[model samples]
Target: MNFYKNNEMVPMTRRYPDLKDKVKKRDNKISIQLIRAWDVERDAEKVLKIFLQNIDKLSSYRYWELLRSVWIICGTVENAQFFSSLMKSNKPNRHYFSTPEEHEFLRSLPDQMDVYRACNSPQDGGISWTLDYDYACKYAKDFQKNMVLNNKINKSEVFAYINRNNESEILIL
Candidate 1:
């Protein structure tokens, strides 16, 4: 689980475009083990096991990055807790924020925010939403049926605010 340190904060999307746009499906067993490993407190052994078992599929660095994306994409309370535990562990990939500024930015958001999303259906709601209306429009252009969705949400409801992508994404569980 090697995390490459960057001189500047680069969005995870830039580093791994597939994380957001075209995530490859994982084996159910691999997915389950990943959840189990992170779900437990400091279960380094489980994390290591998954890495070793899937070495042929991904490098350690990419594996951890994929996990980071999954954490954000899932936007579940359990996944959030798992990631928090992972950050506290002694693993080489414990680094969560690219910089202190990134951390501070997330902490400094207002108590309430207007968030938006672009999806295929009006009823479609997902964990990921942007704070920028223009960016939401950018996403809406992707599909003929895509519609822009917006809502005002309390800060407490935001599962994560990742400015690394410069998208002002707010993940709600």
Candidate 2:
């Protein structure tokens, strides 16, 4: 589900302003897959860099799906073993955050939303929110000042959002 599909389209005069302001409808359920963009030739850091560089290709619905999945994965009361399992590598041949660079990348995933944007401004701008990661940008401006994260607020007015965490948040993703 791409975000631009259902988004209110501008007139032919506008020529589609920016990809970030567009959004499509969301489904009750979402599917997510964790991708490790690395192989033996490329270390985890290199993989992560490429992955981050490609963040702007995702759509708004895909972004929502990704964030919701990240919320489910990171924001929970699961036990230590569960957390440990989370730490465990999803791969049989590689390690989770095996390299120091990989560890830093994972640690900074949430805050690096800006960096991701700066790194990948081309190839469209949807990927920033689509790929699975932390630090969601519910709004296009959350990376900047005037951030608005709660997409489902106030009859589509997102000044205030009721996030999946059930917490009332302000205008920042």
* Top-TM-score structure, candidate number: 1
Worst 10 residues of 1 by lDDT: 13-22
Cα deviation in Å at residue 36, candidate 2? 9.5
lDDT of 1 by residue, 48-128 (tens): 567557745643345555455444444443344555554343444323423345546656888888998877765544566
Q: Among all windows of ten consecutive residues in candidate 2, which has the lowest summed lDDT?
A: 24-33
TM-score of 2: 0.20
Tell me the lDDT of model 1 at 65.
Answer: 52
Misplaced by over 4 Å in model 1 are 1-66, 70-99
* lDDT of each residue in 71-108, candidate 2, tens digit only: 33342223323323423323321221122332333344
- Cα lDDT over the full model 2: 0.29
What are the per-model numbers of colliding residue pairs? 0, 9
Give residue 159's error in model 1 in angstroms: 1.3
The superposed Cα distance between candidate 1 and the true structure at residue 162, in angstroms, equals 1.7
